[model samples]
Target: MQPIALITSPFTDKFSIPRQPGLAPSVISTVSFVGDFDHTASIEGIQQYSHLWLIFEFNQHRSHQWRERVRPPRLGGNKQLGVFATRSPFRPNNLGMSVVKLVDVVVKPQIKLVVSGADLLDQTPIVDIKPYVPYVDAIPEASSAFAGDEPNQLEVCFSATAEAFIDELTSNAAKSEHYQNLRQVIIEVLRQDPRPAYHASKQPERHYVSQLYDLELNWYVTGQCLTITEIRQQKDF
Candidate 1:
């Protein structure tokens, strides 16, 4: 299906993206509609809703091949489960659904949506948007099985370098609000620990460097504490 809009976020890459929505609540993103859908008529009543369901594409996955069985990171990435049983992206159809807080809906000039708690990668394509109906959507006795438990959160500490970089970023006149959320998002992201499930066993011997927006995050695991060793702006941009 053709995308009605494309979403933009600070998550420039998937390497450090949150596994699901609401995990990093401070991170905000926008959906700017295009083509025929970028009009007030298409979303006349959108602003009334407090939350929306987004049907989006996994545009960054290089392969569209289907995997009948998959290992889930939540299950330590060791046990194989049927593809249908998990939210594996390597499915027959690489479609994803997420519930995001409807921060605002702007209809004038061009259709745009402000949302929070989305797990989509930067520049993700959105096929559909629907208002969330709490009466039907929020079932009281839902059984999530393995996904019922909350993910473990580690202690995150910012070093002097990280603090300095974040302070400077928030002082930017044009992009202060966006970067202001970055610090909280970073803490939430790291608290949940961005390392792959397999990499957890090797954390003591390994170091990681990933990007969020134009900043490079240098971090390592020491005991139960995850330290931000350095934070630098990427020079490529």
Candidate 2:
């Protein structure tokens, strides 16, 4: 199927994205319609809904081979399960779905959607969009098996240098709202502890780097705390 839109998000890399949507609500994204689907009429009345279900493709792994059984990060990447039982990207269809909060629907100049709590990587292709019906979509008694509970959150802290650096970055005039919420966004993302599941036991003291927007995050986890060691702006090539 052809793509209906593409996502513009701060998560340039999959390494640090939250395992699930709404895990980092402060991170915003734009869903810009593309090709033949770039007409405002296609999404009339979409603004009435507070949330949407985005059907997207794992375009980054389009060329990769699919396996019948895969290891899930939630299982510490140790236990293997059938591919259909997990949400691993290495699937035969390479499709993914997420429920995102619809911040706004822009119809002028070009059709676009301002959404939040999206875990999609930058430029992920969207196949379809559907309004979220709370009555039917939410299952109060649903059982999620081993993934029933939310992951534990770590206490995210910033170094004095990291705080000052964030201040300097947001101090400039004409900055966008996303720029102003940089600190909180970083905190929300880090609190999820964006590390490989196995690393918690194997490489607890390792330093890690992740890309968010135009910035490079330098962080480390110790005990139940995660610290931002540095934040650097990536230079344009």
Candidate 3:
């Protein structure tokens, strides 16, 4: 039997998408189908699952030929390691995987999905989608080799104006759910400090605006301390 797949993304461009899922929960993305595959029946029972495993192509990095070993940013980009041991985009197949939250599915003119915690760039081609089974797939004892233990605790402070903006956005009934989730997601990602480790010594104050779906986030970093200064609707961007 021949294998078939579809690709789609909710991001408008690569600049807005997170490098990893759960890193930006406020970042919502879409996963649509290709041609004839666009239909509700294709995902008839998907709503029952809260999360899913997305198999997609690393289309942007396809030009790079596969290598036996590659460097991982998580390891500070200094050591070369086996390709399978890392989530490097440079691979023989240029494939990528992400576990994402399933927000909703719309079927009308075509099958369109609204998902959260997506790490794929906008318009990314989805190769496959499978329901995430927490019972069987969640391995608490599994070890994260080389990735090392989770990083140290980081501080996050919000400016008064930024807090006010978040309050307003969350208070709005139409966007409360999106606002709350996005806030938490942004905070979590910032705590990890997405910048390169080598740049840790550079304490320059920098600002970040991250968005997913309806929520827009404005944040900044000063030394080891980070601040989420604002949250609003994407339209505000």
Candidate 4:
């Protein structure tokens, strides 16, 4: 498929992103068209729909060998499920589909689509965009045996350093508005504990660093509790 656009997401690395679309509505992202795809005519009437279906490539997750069975993080990584049964990125096609809430469509010097609640990695190439028809797309009878429920939550607390860091960022008039909203982003993300399933229940002086927008998140987990040790702009890292 031809590339239509690329996503600018806060999830530069991947681990910090939500497991699926709509899980992190606060983490807004943008879709900018490549070349002629930016023509306003291409997106005519696209904003009429409340949500859109994104066909994007899992470009960075290319795999050398295909595996018949894959470990699902939601299953605690112990049980193996057929690759076709899970949304594992290591596939032959490496394609991903997501439904995201369309916030707005901007057209001026360049055309840009602002959307919320996407799980795509930064710089993910988009193949196509389609409006979601509620009549057919919202299937009430759909069910997933294991993936139906939301992710388990962990208690999140910010360390003194983390709190101070947040204050420092939000205190600046230049970035206060954005940083204020980012506080919850930190809690919600850490509350889900993005650690690998195999690393569960282990706290051996481990610290995880992740990025969101221009901020860098440094955190650690203890039992069911997570503490944000620090959060600073990407430049300081």
| Residues forming the 10-long window of minimal summed lDDT in candidate 1 | 173-182
Clashing pairs in 3: 7-125, 7-126, 8-126, 10-30, 27-212, 28-212, 162-229
What local lDDT score does residue 3 receive in model 4, on the 0 to 100 scale? 89
Clashing pairs for model 4 are: none
Q: Please write out the lDDT profile of model 3 over residues 1-237, one tens digit for every residue.
A: 111334344344454455567666665666766566776678889999999998888778867899899877677767989999988888888888999999988787657778877777766778788999999989888888876565554687878877777677778888675445545655665676666555565645656666545456677777678877776665742
Candidate 3 vs. true structure, TM-score: 0.73
Ranking by TM-score: 2, 1, 4, 3
lDDT of 1 by residue, 1-237 (tens): 799999988788777788888888888899999998898888888888999999988876647688999998899989999999999888777888999999988776878999998888888999999999999999989999788878888898999988988888788877686575778888877787778888888557588887787888999987789999899887633
Give the TM-scores of the predictions, in the order they appear: 0.95, 0.97, 0.73, 0.92
lDDT by residue for model 4 over 26-141, one digit each (tens)?
77788999897889889888878999999999888665566789998899889999989999887778888999999988898789899988889889999999999999999999
Candidate 2's TM-score: 0.97
TM-score of 4: 0.92
- Which residue runs of candidate 1 sit more than 4 Å off their true CA positions? 235-237
User: Candidate 3 at 10: error in angstroms?
Assistant: 7.7
lDDT of 2: 0.90
